[model samples]
Target: MPGKPVNTATKNERKLNFWERLYLPEVLKGLGWSIRKIWKEPSYTFQYPEEQWYPSDNYRGRPVLVQEEGKTRCVSCNLCARACPPMAISMESREIDGPKEREPVWFEIDMLRCIYCGFCEEVCPEEAIVMSKEYDLTFQDREEAIFGLDRLLVPKERLADRLAFLRKQQNPQFGSTWEYPRENNRHSLRDLTTDAESIQTEQ
Candidate 1:
């Protein structure tokens, strides 16, 4: 009642020698290679808490809201929230009298749900949100992990390194299309309507 042989082996398959069949030689060879490399090179592992590693500007760490001129750069367009893979970003937009007519009444990013994928940063039209160099995060409770505007807003000056890096490393396909404009957040449908009315009056 035994099943027939599958015969899956190729004709070119080489038979293993006595040492190869045992597999001990191969394991020892791998160990020797690892030990040789370790002896020849400096230790690659960092002594955590004592030796801190500063990541490059290209590294995507915790996401933060960019603040400029005593105001949040975000116009509450909700593009970041929409692009977030884990739906970590949430905000409530409110009508305001400033040049930027719409602003986030309360912007929040749940660190517990955030994957730090940088999708939010890539889709932010106003460059209002960008990844920062902070890697260490610890929360005692669920509420502590939810980062609100008070914890998220970072001064533009402090984030200059990341901003410059982003500008320099823009996608080739985008060309100059994704260039950050400081006044873009100020632009709204009202401005377009006003411009149209002025043009009509002139005509």
Candidate 2:
């Protein structure tokens, strides 16, 4: 970059051929292959809502507001808020009557501003938060875009699957914040956070 620089080839010499310049031939060839493959395997066109596509390994999608056993892993530490570069996380905490780690009475995540960098999940002392693989997060309204604790809580069945999946994605058990399970075993709500052992919220 400092010197006048070396020119191995001239600009005119780096040009494409007539067909390549036009680009139609290549496009058509790819289309032809795709059409034939789709015809052969109709499975490619996903039946969305009913059947979702397999998410990518690196795809950081929706945030799941996990309640292990019956408690959220988040201790109202605001570590995730500190960790988020985008300031997408907003949470409020309150102490319940019985003994338990502080819980987020109101937890909200602004997906529009989220970087999905997986920082919250990594920095989590309790492993209470995780990024769901499903990325098709579309909403009809802007208000819906801001995922609240209820909206973020993955359905019971999905949570079960995600917990099982996370067991495979291992890391050193967290001690700085709380003891995270190595096997990602199911903890009842009572086992997770609250003393009641199981507190049901209207989902």
Candidate 3:
């Protein structure tokens, strides 16, 4: 027990040296790296006419519903309405000429109050409601942000075109029949360049 007879080191034996404690060098290194990037890439942003930022692959943002010919996306099930966290979504499903296929007579989403939790999209059985990847959505007034049935309604063909892999990933039975073949061109929004040339140019 010669070596273990006594413990000379204290509990706080490990301590940072002057350089480690200061951390000034690390901060300078990071600043230098960022400055180098700005200098390295002079013309990295897109020119509006030439390019644009692609939306995210699995982003859940703005709410939209697929509308077909003479049909609203909602099926009067009231799932989305019931599942809303902030109760921002309002829907009234009524008979669409025929009692068989019910559609939303009244639909409005209060974007100002909407928390964007994607709860409505998850609860939708018909997959009618979904959060779009577009997050730059702006509104001049609070009322304008409150999207109505007419504004929220998106043609199935348009949605299908926007999200090529959407059909393949969704349930076949619950899938929107308005689907066409995949565009076969799935790209991440991060990979695309934003239209910065216009902003960079003179006012």
List lDDT for all candidates, in order: 0.91, 0.73, 0.72
TM-score of 2: 0.57
- Please state every model's RMSD to the true fold in angstroms: 5.4, 11.9, 18.7
lDDT of 1 by residue, 11-129 (tens): 99998999989999989999999999988989889999899999999999999999999889999989899889899999999999978899999999999999999999987878999
Per-residue lDDT tens digits of candidate 2, residues 1-203? 58766876676796788998899998998999989997687564667789767775545777777776655667776778888899999999987665555888889999888878988887676768888886777888888889887777764456565666666566435533445664354234434664333345422
Question: Where does the lowest 10-residue lDDT sum fall in candidate 1?
Answer: 179-188
Ranking of all candidate structures by their lDDT, best first? 1, 2, 3
Candidate 2, residue 46: CA error in Å?
A: 4.1
For residue 108, give model 3's deviation from the true position in Å: 0.3
lDDT for model 2, please. Answer: 0.73
For every model shown, what is its TM-score relative to the native structure?
A: 0.67, 0.57, 0.57
**Model 3: CA > 4 A from native:** 1-36, 41-51, 97-100, 161-167, 170-203
| Tens digit per residue, CA lDDT, model 3, 84-169 | 88889887777766544787778899988788888887667677887776676789998899999878888777666435555466
The C-alpha stretches of model 2 lying farther than 4 A from their native spots are: 1-51, 56-59, 69-71, 155-157, 172-203
